[model samples]
Target: MSDRAPQPVERQLPTEEARDLLALVRELAQREIAPTAAGEEDAGHFPREVFALLSRSGLLGLVYDEEYGGGDQPYEVYLQVLEELASARLTVGLGVSVHTLACHALAAFGTKEQRAEYLPAMLGGGLLGAYCLSEPSSGSDAASLRTRAVRDGDDWVITGTKAWITHGGIADFYTVLARTGGEGARGITAFLVPGDAPGLSAAAPEHKMGMKGSPTAQVHFDGVRVPDTRRLGEEGQGFAVALSALDSGRLGIAACATGVAQAALDEALSYTAGRQQFGRPIADFQGLRFMIADMATQIEAGRALYLAAARLRDAGKPFSKEAAMAKLFCTDSAMRVTTDAVQLLGGYGYTADFPVERFMREAKVLQIVEGTNQIQRMVVARHLAGPESR
Candidate 1:
C-alpha cells in the first residue's frame, strides 16, 4: 500500500468560514489524532486530553448558541466536523456527539436562568457531560424507565441505574430522566445533575468489541439529591425532551458512521493500488476494482443522506424520520464497506496489523447504538403510516 496519507475529501461547504473550519479539523485530525489511534485503542486508553483540547478550541459546541459560549454553527457544519474527527478516531467523534446529547435537555427545555447559569461551562468551560435515559431493563422502550425522583420540599432525591452511558464515570455533569409521577411516558421528567452528587457512581467500563478507548458503563444514582432548580422541563415532559435530543443525536451517529466507512475505503484503495501479484498490482484485477467502486458509492450515498437530514434540521423542519433513515443506512453501509475493505486486503485485513479489522468491529456498534436498525425501521414506518396496532 502507498505510504502517503489519504487525500482530503472534496467538500461543498456553505461559506468560507465553514471551509476554513473543515481545513482546521483535517489538520488537527492528521496531526493530533490519527497517529496514535491504533496504539491507544489497543491499550484501551481514553484520550481525555484530546477532548480538553477540542473544548478549548471551541469545537465542542458548534451547534449551540454563541451567546452561551457555543460556535452557533448550523447542524450541517457540526455534522461534517464530526465526520472529520471520526475519520481519525471514532472515540473522539462519538464522545462529542454524546456530550452534545447530554447538553440538549437543558439548552432546549430549561428556563432562562438555567441557561445563563450552566450553558457556558458545559459548552466551553472544559466540562464533559453524559445523558442518562436508558436503564438495565429499558433500552428501546425508554418511556417505561423505572428511575424515580421524589420531591422533598426543596430537593428531589433520584434513585436508579442508567446503563450503556457514554462518558459515564468521567463526565462533569449528567442529564437524567426519571419517573416523577406515575405510569409510563407521561410520568417521566428531566433533571440536570452534577456528576459529583453524593450518591452518583459508575461501574467499571464494559469490555467492548471495538472503540475500546471510549468508556461505556452503568451509572448509579443511589438517592442522589438535586434542587428543584435543576429540573429541566415541566413534570411529565422528560420523554419529549429525550426524544427531541435523540432526533439530533441520530444524525451525529450517521455522520460518524460515514467517516469510518470513508477511512476503510481509503485503506482498501491504497492497499490494492500498491500490492503487486503475478507481475501486476491487485488494482489491475476487475473484481477488486468493482468492489472499490461499490464501497465508494456506499460512502457517498451515506454522506449525502446525512447531509440532507442535517439540512432539514438546520431549516427548522421536522426531520425525525429522515434522521432515523440516515442512521440506519449509514451504519449498515459502514459495516458493508469495512467488511469489503478487509476482504480486499486478503490476509492482512484479518489481523490487527491493519486498521480495517478495527474499523469492521467499530462499525458493528454503530448499528446497535443510538437506537438499533430495527428501531429505525419502526420509526420510519410510524412516520409513514401512524402508530402500530397493539
Candidate 2:
C-alpha cells in the first residue's frame, strides 16, 4: 500500500471555476474521506455525516439547474468530481451518483411547482435520496417491474418490493417507478415517495462481497400512499424518464471505476518502487514495468472515454451509445487493472493489510452495478443493430 497520497489527476476543464471545483473535491476527499475509508468499510459503517458535509458544500448537486440549488456545472465537471471522490471512497462517490439519479425524475420531468417544493432540499439541503426501479424480479428488464400503484380518489397507494437499492434503508426520499395501468413499460408511472411514508419499510441490508459500508437492501412499499401531486411526468412516461436518468447514471459508474483503477495503479507503482527484489527495486524489472504501463494506459483511456460521453451529454447531443460504451470499457478495465495491481503486489495484495485487496473486491461490483457489462454491450449493440425483437 502507498503511504504517500496519490498524485492528482490532470484534468482538462472548460473553465477556471471547474478547475477550482476539482481542487476543492480533491482536498475534501483527502481530508475527510480517504483516511477513514478502510476502517469504516471494515466496520460496515455508512458515513452519513460525510454526505451531510457534501450537501453543505454544494457538492451534492453539481449538474442540475442553479435555480434548484444545483451548482449548474456541466456533466464533464460533475463526473471528474465523482472520480476524485471515488478514489478516496467508493461508498461516497457511488452514493452521490445514486442520489443524483434519484433526483432526476422530478428535476427533469416534474412541474415547476414540484421542483420548487422538493428539488432544493433534495439537491443541497442535506437530504439523501434513492432511486427505486429494480424489483426482485426485474433487474435488466426494469419495464417488467410488478410494483403496483393503484389510484383511489386523488391518492395512489403503492405496494411491492424494490430490491438492490443503495441508500435503501437510510435515504430521506425515494423516486419510485410503479405500475399504474395495464402491463409492461407503458403501464409504469413515476412517483416521489417520502422515505417515511406510511407502510414503507426496508429489509435488513444484503450481505455483499464488497462495498459493505454502502447499504444495499430491499425496500418494501405496502400500501404506501401518496397524492397524485407526487406523480412525475405523465402516466406511462415513467420508463422514458428512468431510461434517460440511467444514461447519465452509467457515466457516473464509469468515472468511479476509473477512480478505483487509478487508486490501485497508484498503490502498485508505490509498492513496486519500494519493495526490493534480488538486491534492486522490483519496478526496475521489465515484466513489472510492462504491466504498470498497461494499467496506466487503461486508466487514461477509460477517463477519456467517459469524458467524451459526458461532453456529448452536455452539448445536448444523443449520447446513450457512448455512455454505454464508456461504462462497458471503463468497468472492464477497472476489473482487469485492479486484478493486475493485486498480482503486482504478489502475496501482500491478497491481504487486508493493504488496500489493493479491497480495491479488487470493489472493482468486481463496478462491473455488475448500474448496468452489468453484458447489459452495456446490449445497449451499445441496440444503437448499432437496433433493439432485439421479442
Candidate 3:
C-alpha cells in the first residue's frame, strides 16, 4: 500500500483563506503524519514533536480568538482540518481536539487576566493539555464525579482521581473538574492544574485496543494546591463549563470518525482493485462492490452531518442536538465501515500488516468518548421530546 490513502473528499469552504488552510493541512498530514503513523502506533509512542511542529505552523490554535495566538478560524474550517489529520492518523487528530476542549473553559469564561496570562501559552506555546472530568466512579453521569476540591486560605486543595485522561502523564497542564461545594453538578468547579503540582501523579497508561500512540491514564490529585485565581469560570459553574466543552468536543469526534471511515474505505477499495480472484479483480464481485458502495455512502453522509453542525456553531446558534446526532451517526458509521474494510482485505486486514485493524480499534473509542452513542441518543432525544420526566 502507498504511504497515503486516497485524497479527501472535496469540501465546500466559504473563503479563499479556508480553502488555502485545508490545502496546508492536507499537505502536512500526507508528508509529516501519514508516513510514520503505522510504525509509531505499533511502538505506542506519542509524537510530541509533531505537536510542536503543529504549534509552530499555527495549526494547534484553530477556531479560537486570534488575539491570544489562536488561528481565529471558524469551526467549519477547523473541523475539516481535523478530518484531514485524522484520516492520516487518529492519534494526532483526536489529540488536537482534546487539547482544544481543554482550552475551551478558560477561553470562554476566564477573566481577562486569566486569558492574558494563559491563552497565548496554552494556544501556541507548544504545551499539550488534558481534560479531567471523568473519574473511576463516574462515566456517563459526570455530575456524580467524586473528586473534591476544598478551599484553603487563598488556594484550593484538590484530592481525587480522574480516569481515561488523554495525554494524561505527558500533558503540560490539566483542566480539572472537581466538587467544590455540596453534592451534584452545580457544586463542582473547574480549575487549571499544572502537571507538576506536587501531589499530582498518573497511574500507568492503560493498555488500550487502539490509538496506542495516545496515552490514557488515571490521574491522581492528592491535595494538589491551586490558587483560587487559577479557577475557571465561577464556583458552582464547572459543570456548565464542562458541558459546553463537550458539545463542541462531540462535533470534533464526529469529524474524526468520518476521517477514520474514509480512510478505511479508501484502503478497502485500493486492496480490492489490486487483488485478483478467479483471474479477475475482486472489485468485480458484486458482494464486495456493494459493501464498498455502502461504506462510501456512509462516510459521505457522516462528513455532511459534521459539517452541517459545524456551520451551525459558526453561525453562533444552537448546535447541541446536531452535534450529538453527528457524533452518534458518524461514530456508528465508522465502526461499520472499518469492520467492513477489514472484511474486504480478508485475513490481511485482520493482521498488523494492514492498518484496518487499528482503524477498527480506534473507531470503537469514538463511540465511547465525549459521550457514548447511547448518551448521544439521549442528548438528541431530549432536544426533540424535552427532558426526561422526573
lDDT of 2 at 89: 92
lDDT, residue 299, candidate 1: 92
> lDDT of each prediction vs. the true structure?
0.95, 0.95, 0.94
Candidate 3, which segments miss by more than 4 Å at Cα?
1-5
Worst 10 residues of 3 by lDDT: 1-10
For candidate 3, the per-residue lDDT at 220 reads: 97
lDDT of candidate 1 over 279-377, digit per residue (tens): 898989999999999999999999999999999999999999999999999999999999999999999999999999999999999999999999999
Question: What is candidate 3's lDDT per residue for 47-84, written digit by digit as tens?
Answer: 99999999888988898889999999999999999999
Count of backbone collisions within predicted model 1: 0
Model 1 regions more than 4 Å off:
none
User: Deviation in angstroms for 375 in model 2?
Assistant: 1.0
TM-score head-to-head 2 vs 3, winner:
2
Q: CA lDDT of 208 in candidate 3?
A: 96
As for candidate 3, its clashing pairs are none
